[model samples]
Structure formats: C-alpha cells, structure tokens
Target chain A: MSCIIERLAIVGVGLIGGSFARALRQAGAVRHVVGIGRSRANLEHALSQGIVDEISFNATEGVAGAQLVFISIPVCSISAMVGAIAPSLAPGCIVTDGGSVKAEIVRECEKLIPEGCHFVGGHPIAGTENSGASASFATLYQGKRCILTPTERTDREAYETVARLWRVAGANVCSMDPERHDRILAEISHLPHAVAYALVHAVGTADAEGENVLSYSAGGFRDFTRIASSDPVMWRDIALMNRRALLASIDGFSASLAELRRRIDSGDSPGLAEFFTIAKQFRDGIL
Target chain B: MSCIIERLAIVGVGLIGGSFARALRQAGAVRHVVGIGRSRANLEHALSQGIVDEISFNATEGVAGAQLVFISIPVCSISAMVGAIAPSLAPGCIVTDGGSVKAEIVRECEKLIPEGCHFVGGHPIAGTENSGASASFATLYQGKRCILTPTERTDREAYETVARLWRVAGANVCSMDPERHDRILAEISHLPHAVAYALVHAVGTADAEGENVLSYSAGGFRDFTRIASSDPVMWRDIALMNRRALLASIDGFSASLAELRRRIDSGDSPGLAEFFTIAKQFRDGIL
Candidate 1:
C-alpha cells in the first residue's frame, strides 16, 4: 500500500476534497496530489498547508495524467465538472465523488466519462456544519462510513481502486445501488437538514410580545438547529438533485407531525404519550 | 443571602427538582430540602446523595412548615400536587415550579393554593435529555435563564423571593406574562422537540431497500435527534398544556417546510438557496 496512487486530482478542493487529500497524504497512500478549485485563495492556502502538492484553476490541466480524480463539489456541478475534465483523464484513470445525492450524479457522470475511464459515486457520511478547506482536518473521515454507489456497468477494478482510497483514509467503505443510496440519503441526511432549517426559520420569525423566539433559545434549541448553519448552496443543490425522494420524505415528516398535532389538539394524552415514547425509543436506537 | 430559605420542599425529585435542591444547597441558600416524589428508590437516592435533607412521599407532609416549595414534576400533575401541599404550607410560603408550560399550570395552581401561601410560576430554561435523580448536577442552572411568569394577581413579594433563589443559583431571572411565556416556549422549545421527535420517527420507520434509515445516521442526525430522547411522559404533559401555541407552531413549521418543498419541487435553485441562506443566518444568530 506504499503510494498506491501515483497522482491524484481533486476538483473543488474544499472541506471534503482537502480532507481526503490530507488523509491520503497522512497515510502516504497518495503521491503528487493536484488540487483544482474555483477559489484561488483557497487553493493557495491548501498548497501552503501542504494539503496538495500542486494547484490548478483549470480542471482539465489539473486532472491530466492523474491516476485518480476525486470530484468533491456542489451536487449540481459535479456532472458538468466531470464532463469538462473528461477528455483530460488518462485511459485507466478512475473518477469518483464526494457528492450527497448519487442516482442522478452517477448517471450523468457515467454518461460523460471516457470509454476507457471509470466513474463511481461515493458519499462520506461525515461532516460538520462548517465547510471549506480551512474547516477540514486529517482525521475528518476516521472511522466514518463512506458509501460507494455503483451501477451494473461500473468497472469492478476501478471500483476497488476507488474503495481502497477511502479505506486508506480510515473510512469503512460499503456499497449500495445508486438509486438506493439516493433514497436512503434523502431520508437519513437530507430530510433532517430540511427539518432543522425549517424549524429555525419558523422559530426565528415567531413573535412573542414582539420578541424574536430564537433570541431566548437554550441548549436544546441550539443543538436541534445546528445543522441549519451548513453551506446553503451545497444543500440547495442536494435538495434539487434529490428532489423526488426529498419531497416524499418531507411528506412523511409532515404526516408524522400532523398526527402529533392532531393528538395534541384532541387532548389525547395517551396517544401523545405513545407517540413520544416510540420516538424516544427509536431515537435512542440510532447508534 | 444566608439561608434565605429555612426549609424547601421539592416535588418530583427528578432531574429538575434534584438539580434545584443541589444548586440551592451549593449556594447555601436553603437550610433543609424535603424531596417528595412517587418513586421511593429515587427519593432515597436523592437523600443519600445529600441532594435533599429528607425525603417524603406525602405531599401534605412534605411542605409542612417549609418556607419555599418547588414543584418540578410533570406539568399535568403540578396543580394536584400543589393542592395536596397547599394546606400544609406555612404563612408566606412561596410555591414555585420548573414546569415548561406556564399559563395553564400557573392558573390551576393559583386557584389550588391556600390564601396565605403564594404561587409563582417559574421555568428554569435548562435540562438534559437524561432524567431521574442520577442526572442531576449542582451547576445545571448556572448561567441559565429562569423565566418567571406572573399574572396580575401574583404576589409581588413571593415573585421577588423566587427570583432571588434563582439568582442565587447563578441564574439570570426575568419576568414575563404567563400566556406570553407559553407562546414563546411553544415556538422556541416545544416546536424544536416536536420536530426532532417527528424527524427521528419518520426516518427510523423509513425503508431504503428494506433497510432502516436510522442505521446509517451520521453526527448531524444524532445531534438533531438528541432532544427526542427527552422524557416521554414529561413531553406529553407539556404538549397538552401548551396545546394551542404548539399547534400554531406546527402549522408555522409546516408552512415553512411547504415553501421549501415548493422551491425544490419546482427546481427553483435561487429560491431554495435564498431559503437556506435565511435559515442559516437565523440559526447563526442564536447563541
């Protein structure tokens, strides 16, 4: 496993990509890392921090001759970035991503990738509300789950190579169908973000004697809405790319909430108690 | 503030009551604390830990000759417990609480207390998801906000006395109308709890290729659902007492969620970004 990757190209060198580069560097698993991003200041900072061996504003030039390319950016832009840099990828180069939604992105990447190259959809189920290269650390992915979504046509050798990188970064890699990954993430991750953001919005706008409700928030309120402070553009793209599943999740949550409201409105004490009891049990069951 | 309270009676003796007694004792503000609750095991544990000077199961006997009484039980039982202890309270005894919902509890307790004894509705805006005497700590209320809700009929001297106790425990005390407190709490605290519980229930029950979504939850999911593990019976009582305001909050949250759904469903990227941007700003505004 000594320098298994000769050269690695990281597009959108933000939190996810910078962390991947740093983790791989720390493990001595990757050599000659090329960081490509829209932010010159960020790329320079990453270079100064020794997170990347080289930097480029042009994805095509950056990815040229790279054995592996990791696309970590907004979900909406991943496919276009892949398309823009496709011709520059080496014949045996494998491309993967750190995108949240997988189905559409994987489909689009598969369609755009060169015939001899490969595309794998990967999502590391790890992050804080903070984003950017400055917010990343070498241990960000330690013991975290990284789900790789591969369709039937995906090249097995390329998939294994990509999985090795995540494994080397201390992540436990698992596989799921592209669509299944999208659906699960929509429920497990996207819906919770939406719920948090909406709760904050509703509470912030609520008035009590003209006092904003959020001003008096305590620890519980702050913890519940912590995810609401995440990168808005990244989440917006995630919501759109995973629209149908997210919509369904929202409906499911709305129904659950409506049932709670009904029980409370009807003064059904037993029913309310039962709902909260089940919720508590289920919440406690999450690892 | 040397032993301002000669004897303090505490009902429920759970996290809130136990913490109150411990904090008061730490401040040397209460000479003796009588811990009253339905659970003999918990009462004995509280007494053993010196959280309460004595333990009692009889509410009437618990408050006899006590200068201050703090009821920190489930909201639904606050009035009945106050009634049972009302005749036993000495003249000028001040009865307060750590209930989340205030208007209804205050009204009910104000009616049940004896003439010489005063009822002051107070809510210490602090707690953990854990409950019972074991979860209590001496500094639980330090630097926390304690909102005292008093009506026009509330005794000024009794209210001041209760405020002094909270201040001695290192709490910043403020006064508000009972109904206003209920509305504000419903939006700030109750709604977030409801959202967390509903989100967890919805995700835990969701199927992804026959897999449970909660199994793959990350740190964000765990943080978002932490409040859902709060005491079920306690939340059930709060939900019932704060029914009207919580119902409105549910509707408000539903509307906010609907707007997000509309933006995502319509593929309005700018709108979705704006929505998330505003939410992030608002959430960041909270301490």
Candidate 2:
C-alpha cells in the first residue's frame, strides 16, 4: 500500500470531504492533506481530529503545490471555488468534485480550470443526515458507488487517477455522462427526498378524529419517512440544482398517486390488487 | 403463568391467528388450541409444528368446546365467520378479532354474536411481509402495540380478558373507540401504504433518459418502500373498508405535495428551506 498521491487539497472538508481524506489516509493513498473551508471552527476541528494535516481559510493558498484537488462543497458554490483555486494549481493537476448534481456543476467547472489542468466530475453517492468533519469516518465510502461523469474534454489519465483513488478507498467507481447521472439520480435519490418531506408535512399538520396521528405512528410510518430527517439546507440546494428533473419527477409521481387514488375511491378490488401486486413484484425484483 | 384458558379456538390459522396460538402456548396460558382455516395444508403445518393441539376445517365444529374464540381473518369475512360460529359457541364465550379496521367489523360481529357470548374488535399492530402459519412466531407481538376497540356495549370483564391475552403475548395493550382507531390508522398506516405502492409503481414504469433508474436504487428507497411488498389482498380489503378516512388523508397528502411542488417550481430557496425545515422538525419531534 504505497502512497498513490503526493499531495491533495480537500476544499470544504465537511462530512464528504473529511471522510474522503480519512479513507484515503487509511489506505495509504495520499501523502499530504490540506483542508479548506469558510468555517474556521470546523476547519480547526478537522485539523485537531487528525482528519487534515493542515487547515486553510484561503482556497488559493491551500491548493498550492497539490497534485489533486477534491472539492466537496455545496453544488452552487463548486464552480466558483474551482475558479478561485485554478490559478494556484500546478500544471497537470487533476480536480474532481463530490456533488450530487453533476451536469450543471461539471459544465461550470470544466471551463473554470486552466489549460493543462484537468477537471473530472464525480459523485460519491453516500451520505447521512449528520454533517461537519466530526461526523466523518474512514469507512464511509467503503462498498459504495462513486460515479465518475467524464465528458469529451476529460483527460483519460486524470480520470483513471481519480477512479483509482476512489477504488483504493473501497468504492466501486463507474464512469458515465454527467447528464445521464443527473437524470438517473433525480428519480432514485432527489425525488424520494422530496416525497419524504411532503409526507412528513402532511402527517404533521393533519389530525385524525382530533388525535395527533403522527405522534402515535409506529415502525412503518417512521421507517417510510426516515429520509425526511435529512438536512434541510442540503436538500433545498439539491432540489433547486436538479430542478427540471426533480419537478418532472414530482409530476410523474402525482400521476401515479392519482391512479392509486382512483382505484381506492371506486373500490376497484381487482384493480387495487393488481396495482399492489405489480408494485410488490417490481420491488421484489430489485431486492 | 398457569393455564388462563382451558380451550381456545383460532379461526383462520394464518399469520395473526397462528402467532396468537404460538404466543399463548409459550406463555403457558392456554391448555388446548383448535386451529380452523380453509387451508387444510396450512392447518396441518400449524398442527405439526405443535402450534395447535388440534385442527378443524369447519368453524362451528372448531368452537364446540372452546371458551374463547379468536378470529384472525380478513375484515370483510369477520362478521360472516362470527355468524357461522355463533351457534356452536358455549355460553360466556369471549370472541375477538384481529382485523386492521375495527369499526365496521366490530359492528357487524356484535350483532351476529349470540346473547350469552361477546364480540370484541382487536388489531395486533404488528406483522411482516411473510404470511401463513409457517411464519408464526411465539414473540411476534413482543414490544408491539395491540389496540383494542371497545364500545359502550362491550362487556367489561370480556374486554379485560381479551386485554390479558394480548398482554401475555408481550404486547402493550391500549383501548380506544373503534371510529378513532380507524381514523388514526388511516393517517399512520393506510395512507403510507398507498403512498408506498404509488412510489413503487412510478419508479418501476419510468425510465430516466432511457435508463431504468429503479435498478440503481439502494438502501433508502428500499427501506422506504418495504411496506409495499405486503400482501395485496389484505391491503385491498383495508383500502375499501377504510375508504372515507383514507381518501381524506390522501387529499391532505396531495395538498402537502402540491405546496412543495410550488416551492421547487418557483425556485423559492427560502420557501423550500422552510418546508424542509418544518418537515425535519416534525420528524425529529416524533423520533
């Protein structure tokens, strides 16, 4: 397990970035780590926890002499962060991201990086409701999917270098177009998040026969709405960044729900049974 | 833990009924158990497993010498089963049910029971995806809630007797009016089932950018839709029996989803954050 990377810069060393740093370090993949963030307290906390060897408030200063830069910031802020650090990065440096939405962020970042330096869009689709460097662990990315979205401009060597690092950290890396990644993720991830939030809101506000039904809910209701406990700011940003796909998904979901409502409303026994059976079969297939 | 009942009749020796027989026997509270069901093979399985002391195909014949009769059948079938067994039950027989919807079943069963006998509506709010007597367990109701719906006409001693049986099964027993039980369950249980089925249907049928996005889903989506794998016939019966309350809950859920859709469609960052924030807060409060 010799060192695969000489020096790495981790921008916004929160949960995702911090976990990346720790996982890479445990695998002996990276030699040096520089953590960057807006929160001085969080950066210092990361430094104290040995998650980062060094801490920097300035993006340009932190990325200096780094062979690879990994940005794990908010989706809306990624391109700007890349632009700020692009001038300081050495020639032939590879820059990758861990944003959930890829197409928009990838397009914005590809143009921001200077010539001779490479930008590869990536999404390590693993997370929890908890945030900050304190919540990170060395095995958070283990056995998870880390999708690399490589465009026409992406450097083959740089892409392999990024994928290799994720693989060493116990992630299954696969490559796809950034546009395809966003579309698929909308249905599987973002849309479920929106539906979970809406369900929680509905149950929280309504009372059945003057009883607060939400409070009396047991394992099934609780398990179904578990994703509603996710971080609000992160989810809000995701909903907006993946707006078109998410909105389309919402509409699609509404139509499906309406179909179910029709069956129940008309008391269509055969129709209802068929609907549930189809759903169960599909779910069982995936499982 | 001495024998609390000399003989017990279990009509429909399926998951609920079979589990009740197993749990009571393990607690040493019932000396004789007679399992009655349409599926002779399943009753034989229950008998072979030592879950029941005897097996009978006819409900009337099964309850001949039993002092307590427990019917764990579909909601629509409970009253008819009661009517069939009422004439055979001895005097002072305490009959109860394990139907999800109580109000309708209780009313129907109460009128069918003979004067000397009593009928109580009970719902064991616990189960798994698997069905039949083979899935029976001695601790299926451990640490779970078993809600009993008792009306003014319900016999006081008979209600306590039913409560004691569930208590011995390791259930937390509570009483509520049948109407209130249906209303609360519509929000907490029935509505969630409908939503889960609709979500599964939506993902199963749609392809994102010509890709079946469902095959790529992981833990969150699977856990959220676990209830969708439930028995279709049981859910269909529940939907029809609790139509009015379930329909109202569905409307409330649609409104909640529509509000969220508006927030995302308009790109209202603060509004989206507020909605998510409220949802997270509510979910947190319950947890």
Q: Considering every candidate listed, which one attains the maximal DockQ?
A: 1
- Residue A34 of model 2: what lDDT? 95
TM-score of each: 0.98, 0.96
lDDT of 1 by residue, B51-76 (tens): 99898888998888999989999998
Model 2 Cα lDDT, one tens digit per residue, B126-226: 88877899988989999989999999989999999999999999999998999989988998899999999998888888853478788778788888888
Q: Supply DockQ values for each candidate.
A: 0.86, 0.83
DockQ score of candidate 2? 0.83
lDDT of 2: 0.90
Off by over 4 Å in 1: A207-209, B207-209
Candidate 2 chain A: minimum summed lDDT over ten consecutive residues — where?
A207-216
True-structure RMSD, every candidate: 1.3, 1.7
What is the i-RMS of every prediction? 0.8, 0.9
Model 1, docking class: high
What is residue B56's positional error in candidate 2, in angstroms? 2.1
